[model samples]
Target: MVNRTNRTQPLSGRGAGTREAIMTAAERLYAEHGLSNVSNRQIGEAAGQGNNTAVSYHFGSRATLVRTIMAKHGTHVGVIRMRYVKAAGDSTELRDWVRCLLRPVTEHHAALGVPSWHARFAVQVMTDPLMRTLVEDESLTRDSLCLTLQGLGRCLYDIVPPEIRPARAEMARHLITHTCAERERTMAEGLAEPGASWERTADALEDALVGLLAAPITRH
Candidate 1:
């Protein structure tokens, strides 16, 4: 099993196009099937590379390959989120910071021009017991996320009880990530109900998160 304990830098760009093709193919395949089930040779064939060793050459191991794909989209998501975070100013509103946290994901998938794979790709990483923390730290941790978390936490401080904050934050992360993955899958399959859009999804999620975060905590 490929795990975070192995840290290998994929040889950069002997053939830039081939490397991207491999990453794209791997991301799509991994999103569809668990990464544990896919093989390097399968990813190589999907990338249109005839050599069975192509994935091993470009990316040292499956762990490195998964990191590469996460980094690919994460950079853009961070940049987009930073813009929203900066735009948010010092507002203490819960929904404002929630938007900062959530919109970048929806907008990123939307910008991918439909049938995007990254959301589902991300859900797999989030659910994986082995790779989850590694990818979360390496790819998903951004200055923008930190800033948004700081801002959001400030808004929640007066509302959420201290002991329950961490659990609530975890729940919020699950809701946003999984919900976006479901929406992306539905849209890709042409099964999204009428009137569904990324913006609307974000709005609904923001509403739910606002209430969840602001709700009173009861000690058992």
Candidate 2:
């Protein structure tokens, strides 16, 4: 029996290009229309494939296709994160670790330029009940990300009370995901504010996240 999940393994030349096109179309459609709202056939059509089953042929099920896309972007982001992690060294500052955590993502989006769909697409996957686990699992496999997260944890161990850490962590996740999604959407629609460059946005996110992670826990 053939493993459909490994179908993309030997791609090259025209086959590789076709696979890339299908993934690109799927990412864009899933970003614009909700993941559940987009169909595999629609992705095929968007990718210029005449056969509606092109997506299934190339990537198997919806979960596999989504995982493939997430893996692509996640790998890219993880690579960029390693650069930041190296630069951070053994710095104990909370904001340095926060920068290590957030800048890779912002830098990836920034390098992709305006009108890119990845940030919003990631938010779509992260927020969806059925698909969220896929992203979480994907995240755990990234060594650089895990190290950065550990750095953040170490920085927060004394500052944030152990009991409320989980809640604050959840809040930080939402802030990073939704905030970047909103910025991407506004930029795509030409509604971004006067000074909305990715660097400035990253700085703002870094500030907010630093404060959020280090804020005094008020226990009544």
Candidate 3:
């Protein structure tokens, strides 16, 4: 799908620094406070842009800024996931494919370490009616992701109800996003569950997701 042209193109040369700064700051603030609460002026001030209009000049609108951040993280996650997908070639085991689904998320946030903003930012965009479509268009639908879903479908075969597969897939998406966001928030705040780490969380999530996907569908 052709990407819709961004209303505000990021500036080149020295202005690029200001643009990046605003994006980073906006992401952090938006993650800490809900999107509706954060404003362009606050984002501009947070980025240290003396000009109050900095965010307006750089991003045009809040939704545009949100999409930029989602695309940034989505690109990184997609690269790592594609590599995993390649490694899982022809493997029908549920765990092998589930790792492809879960690891990129946990691993990316893990690499970002504490105070990462993308997970929270993602949840916000997903929950919002308008912003959710922007994210799904730019980041969620991709050949690599579709390929992974195909692999999972192959793994489940005739076990899962075909009619209900879409419902189950959506459930899996919600679980991973919320779980990781909460984990990121607590870990950043030093409230992580008793010596827990992203690695351990990934393992636990992998186990649960595998069971969730592979569990037999009970027909009424």
Candidate 4:
């Protein structure tokens, strides 16, 4: 068997374009078949390359490729979330922070025309411990959302106890993840149903998120 780790044969001209094509194809395939099920060869084939080398040349490893796709997209998302946090004007209220954290993701899904595959991909990342670890290690940074989350925790600390802040953050993260998953499922169902609109779904989701995050914080 060919060494799957080897780089794809380099294109003679338009190397950058070829690399981008490979990345795009890999992202789509990974979203469809999942990280575990998809192989480098398959990605190359989808990218219009002759063999698996393209994936290796551009990304070095399967893990890196997945991380790259997420970072390229997720970093932009992080920026949007950070902007919302900045706009909150130092309130640091738990509900406000929660809304800021969630708004960007939900808006992105709404704006991008949520594909059915995105939900499945997100669900896999949410539940898989190894994948989560990889995400933290390779995709996230200290100054990124992780720091922003810590800041949010400090803001919430005024209301919730120190020992429990970690737990609360975890709970909040799960809540957001589940909400997104549910939104995707709703979208999938709505596509089959008559008169389904993303705008309606986004409005309802925003309302539900505010209620979900607000109730707990207000109770404290």
Of the candidates shown, which would achieve the greatest TM-score relative to the real structure?
A: 2
lDDT of 3 by residue, 14-120 (tens): 77888889989988998888889998889999999889877777777788889888888888889989998999999988899999989998899999977788888
User: TM-score for every candidate vs. truth?
Assistant: 0.91, 0.95, 0.92, 0.74
- Name the regions of candidate 2 deviating beyond 4 angstroms: 1-10
Model 2 shows how many backbone clashes? Answer: 0
Q: Which ranges in model 1 have alpha carbons more than 4 Å from their true place?
A: 1-14, 139-141
Whole-model alpha-carbon lDDT for candidate 4: 0.64
State the C-alpha lDDT per candidate.
0.86, 0.88, 0.85, 0.64
lDDT string for model 4 (101-177, tens) is 66777766666574544545666665768777877675457344665576566665665666656665566667667
Cα lDDT tens digits for candidate 1, 1-220: 6533343444455577888899999989999997888999999999999999888877778878888888878889999999999999999988899889888988898898678888898899889877787788875458998899899889988887678888988898899989999999999999999988898998899899888878887877
Which of candidates 1 and 3 is the stronger one according to lDDT? 1
How badly does each model clash, as a count of residue pairs? 0, 0, 0, 4
Best by lDDT: 2
For model 2, residues 1-220, the per-residue Cα lDDT tens digits are 7665546463889978998999999999999998999998999999999998788888878888888888888889999999988988888889988988899989999988889999899888988887899779878879998889888888887787778878988998999999999999999999999988889889999999989989976767
List of clashing residue pairs for candidate 4: 7-53, 7-57, 8-53, 8-54
